[model samples]
Target: MKSSIVIADDHPLMLKGMMNYLSSLGYNIVGSATDGSTAYNLIVKLKPKIAILDIRMPHKTGLEIAQDCKLNALDTKIILITFDKREDVYKKAKEHNIYGYILKEFAVEEIETCIENVICDRPYFSKELVPNLEKTYTNTDYTSLNKLTKTEIKILKQIANNKTSIEIADDLNVSPRTVDKHRSNIVNKLKLHGIHNGLFIWASQNKDIF
Candidate 1:
C-alpha cells in the first residue's frame, strides 16, 4: 500500500511545494500544516505512516514533536527537514529515534528517497551531513561533545567534579547502574574505546562546557 504522510513547515510556500511534490510522487498526502502544534495534533489524530516536519516551527519544533512521538510510542516515523547543520541538533534527532534528517535545499532531491527508506524501517540522513556526522565518530574536541545527551552532560559534569558514579546516582536520585549506563553511552558516543578512565579524563578537560 502507498504510505500515508503528513507534512508541516512554517514556510507556506515550502509547505505547499513539498506537499504537492510528494503527492506527485504518488504518496498519499493526508495532511499538511504550517505550524508545529497543529501539525502535531494532525499527526496524532490521523496517525499517518510518516510525518515530515520543519526543524524550526512555531509552537513546537520538529525535534520536540519527534520526542513526543517517541515518548508516546506512536508508530509515525518522523523526518526532520532543516537548513541547520549543527551537530547537536543531529545528535538530538538521533537520540529521539527520528527516522530521517534532510536538508531543506536537498529536500526536493532527497525527500522521496528518504520517505522510501524510512517507510521500509530504514533510517536516512542527507548526504551533506556525512562529513560532519563522520567526524563525531573520530574527533575528540568540543565538536564531539555534541554527541552527549543532557543527562550525560550532567553526569559528566559531576564526574569532572570528582564525584563517583554512586555519588552521582545519589545526587540525581537514580540508581548507580543507571548512572553507569549513561556513562557507557557517553563513552560510546565520544568513541573513547581502549582508553583508561576516558570519560573522567575527557570530562575533566571539558569541564567548561558544563
Candidate 2:
C-alpha cells in the first residue's frame, strides 16, 4: 500500500503543517516528530512505507537516519525536506539513497509529486533545484507516460473504458491484486496525483497517447 507516512522537522509549525497537508491528501500519517531521533525511532517502530524528514534536526540529521535505514536494511524510502539547495547535499542524499529531495519553500507545492514518484521507485527532486538534477530527473513532460510497460498500457485502456479491477484482471488473465498493482504503476508512471479518479480520468482523456 502507498500509505503510512512518517514526517519530522525541528520546527513545530513545519512538522504540523506537513502532517496536516499529507493527511488531507489521503495519505496515512502514521506518526510525526519535532526531532530527527524521534523520527527515526518512529520509523523503526511503525515501519511506515515512507519517511519525510527535515534535512537537519537534533540528535540525527535526515541523512544520518537515511544511512541508518540502509545499514539496517530497512525498506522505508526516505524523502528529505530542506531549505538547503547545495549540490553537495543533493550528492550526499544520493549516496544515502534518499528517494525524494524537496525544498521546504515549495514543500506544499512539490510534496504530492515527490511522494508519487518516490512510491513508484523514481527519484524525485524539487524542480526549483533543476541544476542539481540529472537529465531524466530534470524538467519532464507528459512523455513520461512512455515509461509504462505494454501490459500497463493495456490495463489503462481497460480503465479508460470504465472497467473495474476484477474485470480487468479477468480479461488479462491475471489476479485482481495484479490488476491493482498495475493501476498503481500506471498512476506513478504517469505522475498523476491530487486528481480525483486520476487513472480513469487520465486514461479517458489521453486515449490516443496510449
On a 0 to 100 scale, what is the lDDT of residue 32 in model 1?
91
lDDT of 1 by residue, 1-210 (tens): 489999999999999999888888798999999899999999999999999999999999999999899899999999999999988888788778888899999999999888987775556778888556645333456677787788998898888776877789999999999998998998888777754345654665567766
Look at candidate 1 and tell me the lDDT of residue 110.
97
Kindly list the per-residue Cα lDDT of model 2 for residues 26-62, writing each as its tens digit: 9999999888899999999999999999999999999
Top candidate when judged by TM-score against the true structure? 1
Count of clashes in candidate 1: 0
The lDDT of model 1 is 0.85
Off by over 4 Å in 2: 132-210
lDDT of 2: 0.82
Steric clashes per prediction:
0, 0
The window of 10 residues in a row where model 1 has the poorest summed lDDT is: 130-139
Residue 131 CA displacement from its true place in model 2, Å: 2.6
